[model samples]
Target: MELTRIGEAAGQRQTPEDLRRREDSKAANNMVTPQEAKERGITWRVAPPEPQVCQFCGQPIQPQGIVLQNMVFLWRPNVRCTCEKAVAYWQEYDRKQAEEKARKEDEERRRAMQSRIDRLLGNSGIKKRFQQRTFPNFRTDTPGRQKNYRVAKEYADNFAYHKAKGDGLYIEGTNGTGKTHLAAAIALQLISEGIPVICKTSSDLLLDVKKAFDNEGVTEAQVLDAYKKVDLLIIDDLGKEQCSDWSMSTLYSILNDRYEDMKPTIVTTNYNTDGLINALTPKGFDNTKIVAIISRLRETSTVMTMAWEDCRGK
Candidate 1:
């Protein structure tokens, strides 16, 4: 315990010989200055190793090209002079090495993530025509149009919060009013951030399910799972699809599952609630189920009316 206390008290302090060497290092700056030497605490070497001049600071470096000066290397560490450059050089070398290693690791992670995102976007059903849509490109010519833009942008930005509540956007407008444009823009923004969003017209959604039944090598459950479980599912042109009992039922199934799972769903439509009801009212079609779906949508979505003049009407 006495030896432990002495060692602890001497922690990190230069020995007397090392201190004397630095105190007189000015006189013999470029040549090996002969001094009393000791090896290990119990053994002494007959002579010191040969010295060389440092290329960095032009000072007499430690003997025998010794580079290791760092602590925690208790056996035969190079105890350096104050003006030695190897310490600083190795420090900088370690810093650059750590930075380079971090950069390469980050790039590898980014490439892997990008490949995964490519597969997701390809399967997202976002058409190439709308791939270029973005918030900055959206026109805000009027107060109403500006409000629509603000709402859409805010929704996309705060999507994680709304998604937590299963809340989404219900875009209502006439054709050519840029409803789908705003929806696609939101999807693209989320996609660029690596969020999993699936944008498809309801017709194409039904058609994909139909194809899955034929030879697509996929099951109906798989199709429904994708739509029902995506982070955000944008169903564009909701009422434009030619509705059948089966098609509407399938749509309801997807929406219902998404609702139960508390997943957000964005729907763009050229129809009001009544117009949507009328559009869905086919010959002897069941109205009860469609009304329930609309009610749920009203509860879970923020209604954004984009009835302003078409910004593209130039």
Candidate 2:
């Protein structure tokens, strides 16, 4: 009956005494126990004390021996197992890696688009034409000039006023002074702020206007447009442009347009108001129009006279 019970528990295949005898016989011959088997790096399973068989292979196992089968929890408790921990760690790492990759790609794309826009704006025909046709580097660094000036704070204040207010400036002094440098400095400031500016010597501008008139395809309107639309217009050596009938009219038109639109202009000249009037009247531009332009500019502008030696020469 004991054998039958053992056989029934072992699926009617083996008796408990038989199995014990076999295990005892094997132990006498120095056979390994289940725990010893596991210590010896062997795979095994242990049976319950109540005559239970191995759930996986249906073999009978000794109660005190280690049954080395994979342990699976129906519900997780406390810390995760090795396999679960490894998988979780890998999942989080991969998610963060993907996010980092996506962010880099977005940043690269934005930079590329910005570069394209800058290229388009910088390479426009209008911009190129202005560079080639207009005076180059006429404005020197103003902050440096302000520092060089003995009354730097005062000069800087005057410059800042014109820059912020978009007011016209009249810089009067003898030749070879720093009038042009100051004017250039203001122009640079405005340009850096994304304001469009045109800096030209009076002689060069007059010559260009004359050439534009003489040339078949060029019109006075084209020249006038470039001058009128700029935020700041700097005319250096103002009394030095070759005055003629067409040049005077062109000058009048530019000044009138700026005056009406409240655009700022900076004139650096060796001549005073009276000198300018005398020069303008000779070309049939009356004093009334000249006075109007000067008055408007004076009302909205600040004048700074530099009587020192030319810093350029120094």
Candidate 3:
């Protein structure tokens, strides 16, 4: 007769060989007590097997985990274990928890960045007309359009360096040749990079100044300072409106402020130099101020002419 351990359950006698094998497994991981095993109608040993019971179902004890303490257990599947269902469930639960945490963190970061972008764009004074235009949507069907697009993209990509070096651009083309589109693309790209850019048409800028004059509550200096202080200033449709004594003077002040400070400015226009001069100094007005403005623009700007016909029809 095989002798049972102290407090062994008084049922299901096991052979000496069988008892020895079971004892080895229990000693390695389980926290079994003879009295407890006897009450449960199971084998008696020094300890229970790892994960003695399925944590989820609390059914069928198995040698699936290691017993680190009297009752505490850690899952460590062994060859003799029959607790596959319980092990798989906990593994999947932990995995899903990790994934959900990561997703939430990513979403939070994205929303924070979008909020910052919105604030910067709001302060930029970019018009609603060109808000949707970007470099990818810019048409490059013609060779000239392609070259112009490439140059504009290069300028945008290296905006920090170009701005630091006091370089600017003069984009001249007929209406509908994508000059405004390209300029807007550059402004949007810089804005996305956390740089502030002001985009407005010459006519609108003059109207803003005029409104300041009419409204004594707003000062002209405050209005003008915004244009001069931005990282980039885009004057779209330059020379499109007839320059007035007040308009020309305001334009000179804004341009000269940037010129003296070495800030970058991009001017989009339909007129060549001669046409621009004609437009600027209409009715035999003294061309000296206009000449001075043009001189400063030419000195710091790389003139890019988009010769393609208007693509608005296409």
Candidate 4:
């Protein structure tokens, strides 16, 4: 009966903390020494009879040494009543409970990570068609292609270093030279690693601002903040956009804010430095305006010219 109380007590509807407190209280009460028991006039036996019956289940309780506690030992120490069936049941129950808890925690973590990745990628402005671009699939056939690949890989690998210095890449080449591929690859990798990145064609960048200005539900400041404050901003097809005074001013403002804040930016272009200046600046507009944009673009970035054959036609 005494030995079986452990299982009986455990089966009670008490909270775990209450159960622990009850067990601790029981231990404190039963810790009387032989002399103390004698002094307290409590009847005691050093050795109890063998094979005591479990009061509830009728299983034989084995006698361990004289500990002056439970199991008909003239006092009480409620050992668990575990016949073979009960022992196996409790062990399996505990194992399953632990496994279920761990599984739930792992699933929660996975869901949270996926949510963050989605938000980052969605806000990154990477087009749906280029979503799957990655460094591993980029072909490096010729010398220039190989050099571009190496440099892009290094940039991505050491992104934290470049990001700190507001350093970026100026990729200039003809169409289908893997320029956009490498830039998209960089953005995808960083987003996967939980970094915030924005990749947009220069045209789309201006278009977004124009939409905000035209009261498309979002404010002009909000759109520009996203462009200026993101960890890395990639402006694709720089000189391809239809240039206007407003477009040049908007580009300069975003670039200037990012530059002053030490935020990194990547630019890809079909035109060389002088050609880009010419394309962005409208006819008869001050050369200094375009020169300022070029100056910052050149000074803040590592100029990489992709002179390889068109990758698309290949």
Candidate 5:
């Protein structure tokens, strides 16, 4: 018991010299004396130094003119009096300025990234040659016929089928029923995935083909080649083109070539199957050729019918 008590007492007691040494070590580590800082050429002034006399105008020095100066030269006096609070305020200001600068740089970087994405979506022709000839004008914010006319799940399935390099699609729907929207949506989605797509109205395409024929030396074969080779082609508003030997024959040739190659083509027509057959068969062209083209198209394409009540006014 006595030995234990003695040991406890010894542990509790510390010599005054030892205590002094500990304090000295801590002070040495933390102390920043003005005299030492002056030798190091660091000045932290909280206010202006007292003028022995004004250098510019002869005047007696005032006590209020003497400002406190730290060893670090970070703080300067606003007025003549030494005030540590002023130094604290200036430090806070500098910290805020640094934060603001960092935030601005971050915002600028975000804007630059968004700009690159926009360029890729809007103007870059990196996907394929077909993208160079067509512009996508669909907007997500358009305020009419909001519901998807194409059943979303089935449409997605069909999209997957085409995307897998399987075959083409045929969309049957009435006007104002979002058939064009579905076609545009598919094209836009493919574009995002780095695939090339060409979208053109059927009537406009026929007119262009007609113009190519009318201009001497410009063979329609070149135009037909362009139509036949794209990754995806969307022929919108079919059965609306003027029926003629050249128009019917040209359309059949493009469709037949794409069918044989197993390339995908999406056609949205207001006409039903019977009407389409009749339009393709219109008196002048060979009926067997028209039948053959339609048969090949049916063999390689999945036909989807989109039916929705007109919702433009409501």
Candidate 6:
């Protein structure tokens, strides 16, 4: 009984302390000691390997060379190059190539646009003989001629705005003035700038319509539509044609359609507005139709008086 009591007292005091010590000892054993590592040939410190060579030029890479790893390019990447000179050469080459490509594209576009302008002007029925007439070449010698020339030039220069605002011109005056010359000059200038234009004398247009009625495969609609749809229609010599019922009616239809559509037109006449009205309203046609046509002209057209004496030497 005495031995059992003594052992129980010792056991109670030592049990917790000994259990903690045993746990600490087990943790210490789990750690890798230096001696054990050496015996196992495990290295804790090592020197890094040498840097990679330049894959591009097979040259030695500089310490501060640009380095990109695992990169993808259009032609096989993961490429590293330290050749600054070669890289610069290729960059310049690519830049020049891009510039050349852009230049060619621009040139091609310009040529195509010019070709389209040429075709439109050719098909516009502007007399080939008058193609050379231009505002620059029109005579500005005398005071009166110079005045008319300046106005015509201004009109030509500002034609883009005139077309946009649906404005037109009624260039009328005495016989010797260069009305037709200025009108043709304006037409050619606008045409050169890619504006669609048609030029025809009043008599010629009426003659065309008459020919269309008599000729097979030619229709009045075709002849009239050509005049109606152009961007600019030049009707030269307004009262030249005889005022028969058919002539007046055809003229009215052309003018009325253009007026309703707000299309711009250039009209040249040897008579003033009143004179033109008188010439058109002869025996027994409709005076209202003549009034209507003249009214639209007065409303939309800028009246330009070319008072210059006839430039052509009599």
Point to the candidate with the largest lDDT: 4
How far does residue 208 in candidate 2 sit from its true spot (Å)?
2.4
**Cα deviation in Å at residue 266, candidate 4?**
0.2
Q: Which candidate ranks first by TM-score, i.e. highest?
A: 1
lDDT of each: 0.76, 0.58, 0.75, 0.79, 0.60, 0.72
Per-residue CA lDDT of model 1 for 58-169, tens digit only, reads 7764542111221111123244545646778778778999999997885676455445434433377789888887888878878877899999999999987898899998
Estimate TM-scores for all models: 0.62, 0.47, 0.60, 0.61, 0.48, 0.59
| Residue 201 displacement in candidate 2 (angstroms) | 1.2
Q: What is the lDDT of residue 86 in candidate 6?
A: 59
Per-residue alpha-carbon lDDT of candidate 3 for residues 1-314, written as tens digits (9 for 90 to 100):
34565336557567898899998867664643444444545542345444454565666454333344343344443333236776787678779999999878856754554453334333455677778889999877788889988899999999868998778899987888888899999989987876667788888777776766777666677678767766788898888776778777888899999999999999998998888888877685787777888888878988889876667867
With candidate 1 superimposed using the best TM-score fit, by how many Å does residue 83's alpha carbon deviate from the native?
42
- Which is the winner by lDDT between candidate 2 and candidate 4? 4
Ranking under lDDT, best-scoring first? 4, 1, 3, 6, 5, 2
Model 2, C-alpha of 36: deviation from truth (Å): 80
Candidates' RMSD to native: 13.9, 27.1, 20.2, 15.3, 22.3, 26.6
TM-score of 6: 0.59
Q: Could you tell me which residue pairs clash in candidate 6?
A: none
**Tens digits of per-residue lDDT for model 5 on 1-314?**
99999998788887898799988786444444344455656455553344344332344433221113424433222232234554566677789999999878856754543354333223222234333322233322433323333343344445646645647677777766666666766766665655555667777677656666676755566556666765677788887877777777888888888887777887888878778878767675567766776667667667766565653445
lDDT of 2 by residue, 256-305 (tens): 88877777787877767788666655555456766666666667666666
Q: Flag clash pairs in model 5.
A: 42-71, 43-72, 43-73, 44-70, 44-72
Residue 305, model 3, lDDT: 92
Query: Candidate 6, 303: how far from true, in Å?
Result: 0.7
